[model samples]
Each structure stands twice: as C-alpha cells, then as structure tokens.
Target: MDLSTVTATLASKSYDKVADICDNLMLQVATDGIGYHDDWPYAIHLLSHFYVNDINSARFLWKSIPSSIKENKPEVTAVWRIGQKLWLRDYAGVHEAIRGFDWSQELQGFVAAFSELYTKEMFQLLLSAYSTISIADAALFLGMNEDDATSYVQQQGWTVDSASRMLTVKKQPVVTEQKLDPSKLQRLTEYVFHLEH
Candidate 1:
C-alpha cells in the first residue's frame, strides 16, 4: 500500500484500514529487507491509537520506535511527549507542551482527540482537591456551560444543590465497633452454653 494512501486514510479516521496498511508495510519491511522509513507509519499508528483512547498501545508504539528516529523527528517527539503527559494525567503539562508549537494536521487531530480526556482529568484533579465545589466554578474550570457541568456532576453520581448551585461529594461513612466488656462477654458465653444444653 502506498504511504500517501495510508496517510489519507488516517486523516479520514479510517483507523482499521490504516492499521492494516501499516501492519502490511511493517511486514514487508521486515521480511523483504525493503528499506522503508518507519516514521510516517509509526506516526499514523500512534494517532490511530490516540484517537481510540488506547493509550497502552500508543505507549508501546512510542517506546518500540528507535531512539534515533525519536531524536531526528521533532514532530514525532512532540506527539510522543504529549501522549506521555496525557498518560501521566498531567493535563496542564500537555496544555503547556502544545502551546507554542505549530502542529501538522495529524498532530492537530491527535490533540483534538485528547481534549475531552484532558477535561476529564482536570475534573478529577479538582475533585481530589475539594470535596464540594460550585457548579459555576466547575463550569469555568472545565470550559463548559453551567448546565453541562451540572449534567456531568449528576452523571458521576455527585449531588448537586440547585439552590446553592454547588456540588456535594458524598463522603463514605466510617463505621466503628464498640468494645465489649470482658465481664459481659463471660456472662454472654455462659448463657449461650446453657441454652445449647
């Protein structure tokens, strides 16, 4: 399969077709001793995995590539770094990393795919810090409207006080057992034995 065809398929989000073409290309390169540069295929494969939220496969692909390739291709390296930040739940780091760089179409698509995940991570970060937060505040933090923020909170099983416009994270209740008196325990044991007879 032509590399341009593979690139076009990936741009069109035909992920399964891209995977098949990439796999065939890899097989050809391996068995026929064909001199094929692996960069483009790897990039497409990485994006395919990212588009599907398959971070483990993406990580494997990123790591399996030659370090020389990583060093030589700045775009690939940048994409890999962003993927790493995403995997690490460093949503802020991903935002910071992509800020000033002019990304190619493929990279732009990859970033767009990750935006929802980034927002989810941001919500988790905020929840970890505060047990209760205002829906307005959550909307602002998540870059969503108030209704959407409220919907998200409700979907997650968090309580929302519409009057206060606040979300309440229900705390798990702690249970404690009362200590038994030794004297009462002996009497209870004797009573149980008598009843058994």
Candidate 2:
C-alpha cells in the first residue's frame, strides 16, 4: 500500500477509506512482514483509528506495535499516552502530556480531528460533577463560547436561568413499558423461534 496515498486520503477527510486502507495494510504487514520499509505505517494506522474516535482500535494497534519501535519514536509513545488519557477522560493529564511538545503534522491532525469530541466529553464530565453551574463556568470548562454553551444545555432539555446565569439539569425521564398481552407475547416468541430455527 502507498502510505502517501493513504495520507492524502486522510488529509481529504476520507476517514472511512483511510480506515479500510489501514486495515488492509496492517493485514499485509502481519502476513508478509514489513518488507523493506520501517514501522511508520503502524503509526499512520493508529492515527487513522484515532481520527475516527475508535479508541479501542487505536489501543489495540498501539499494543501490536513492537516496543523497540515505540521506544525509538518518542512521538508515537507520546501519542499513545495522550490517547490513553483521552479514553480515560483524564483531561488534565492529556493536556499535561502534550504540553511543551512540538507535535508532527500527523499528530496535530489527529488532535484537531478529536478536538470537538473531546470538548463534548469534557462537558459531560463537568456536568456529571456539578448539577448546577454558571453558564460562563460551564462554557469555560467545555471550551465553548457562552452562546454555544446555552445552546448545548437547551439541546439536552436542561433549563437555563438567564436571570441567575445558572443551568439546571433535570434528570432524564426513564421510559417504562406496560406488560405485553399474553397473546402478543406468544406471537413474538413464536416469530423469534421461527427465525432462529
């Protein structure tokens, strides 16, 4: 597989295609060894997974990479650590891990791709920790503007008190279903059994 073509696809935001190519390339590497090339392809494969928010896949790829290669490329190791912290929702740790480091173009792209999703996760974490918080504070925590924060709260059906500048998060309603009629249950069971057989 041509790594440059894969990189171009990624740069064009063709994430699904990038994923497919990365999978095929990794399979080739596994079955046919690295050939005459180095392990940079593995790094690209990990980045593709990360770009699509497939943290588990990225972690699996990271583990599959040889420890010697990871040690030689500090950037790959750093990316792995950042990915781990991101998966664990350790926002502070993630920030600390990447601080003062000059990221490569590929690493920068991965971070940029995940930025919005990471902000959303951070917002969820903040909301879980605080039932009621000022909109400004929430916006700061979420790395969003005040208007965006208000819109986000509204989207979740949470109440925002403009006068108090506070957001009130009502618990989501639990949906309970009425018991099925005996005849309906019997019909469903028969249908399922017929499909299984």
Candidate 3:
C-alpha cells in the first residue's frame, strides 16, 4: 500500500492495530539490504504514526534513520528533536533547539509551515509568558483596583513585570490627540507669558 493508505489505516486503527503495523514495517525498512527506493515510503509511514502519539513507532523510525543521510535529512532530525523536546516538557528548550536551524530546510518544512499559524500576538504572548506573570498579578500592576483584577485580566493582556518580579507588566497606552486639551493649552500659554516677564 501507499504511504497515505498506511497513514490512514494506522490513524483509524486502535493503538494495538497501529503497534502491529509499525512492528512489521520496522522489520522491512530497518534491514540494510533495501535502498531508499524501498525504504522512504515506510519511513514516512513510521513518522506519521507519531502524529497520533505513537512514540514507539516514531522511535523505531528515528533509530532506523541512517547517519550517512542525517545532514541531508535535517528535517527528519529536526522534527524528531521537536517532538522529543515537546514530549520532555522542555518548552524553552524547544525554541532554543530549533532557533538556529532554518525550518524551510528541515523536515517537510515543519517550522516554516507552522510558523504562519501562530500570530505575531500569539508569539509575543509566548515570549512574555512565564511562571511569574499570573493573570491576577498582571491586573494589579495595571493600576487596577484589587476587586477589578479579574475583570482587567479578562479584558486586557498583561505581561510579567521583570523588574518588580511581579505580574505587573500591563501598561495602558497614554492617549494623545493632535489638538491639546483646551484647559492645559491655556495654562501653558499663560505660564509662558509669565516666564517672559
């Protein structure tokens, strides 16, 4: 069967069904005798299994990857590392591990493909998010009354206050208008006239 068929069957199958298929495919592709002509399809199939959380199937595919082709196949390695880091709860490490690597050059352009899905705001949110910036704390930092913290949190986005080590990163942008406030403008003019005297 083709790679798509294998993927569909594996995805539709129960965990046990997938495990069995993976076991057979592993044997067929892991052998040194078959060239890429025979092995690439199975490799793609094995990697797809991981999409459904079949870590073992993914592990088999990873182990079967030839060292000789690792450089040329940076994407396979990059995808595997991305999965590994995510599975290991190394969120920060995931960014660092893939930072220097161009996703366009890696496996199926995984990062390049997914980067557009994340908005600029979402990316900034990830960058600003940390253990210290809890929603409640951010509201208070925004000059919100104690009782209004919850409301502010729901309505406004806040960042972690790095200096105070509190969730006080939320700042309201000061609104300015081309026409100055009439009262303030008059007061400023009077002050300037007094200074001239």
lDDT assessment of candidate 1: 0.71
Instruction: Report how far residue 61 has shifted in candidate 2, in Å.
Output: 1.4
- Global CA lDDT of candidate 3, please? 0.49
Candidate 2, after superposition: displacement of residue 149 in Å?
Answer: 7.8
Angstrom error at residue 59, model 2: 2.2
lDDT of 1 by residue, 1-197 (tens): 35787767757856645655665677776697766665455666665666566788788778778887888877777777767876886655666555546777765765565556567867777777779999877776665678987888778778999898889865545578999999999999999999999
Error of 3 at 106 (Å): 8.5
Model 1 segments beyond 4 Å from truth?
Answer: 15-21, 98-100, 116-197
RMSD of each: 9.5, 6.4, 18.8
TM-scores for all candidates: the values are 0.54, 0.60, 0.39
Model number with the top lDDT: 2
Per-residue lDDT of model 3, residues 56-130, tens digit only: 757766677677555566655766775575467454444454554664421343343232222232334533654
Winning candidate number (TM-score): 2
How many clashes (backbone N, Cα, C below 3 Å) per candidate?
A: 0, 0, 2
Clashing pairs in 1: none
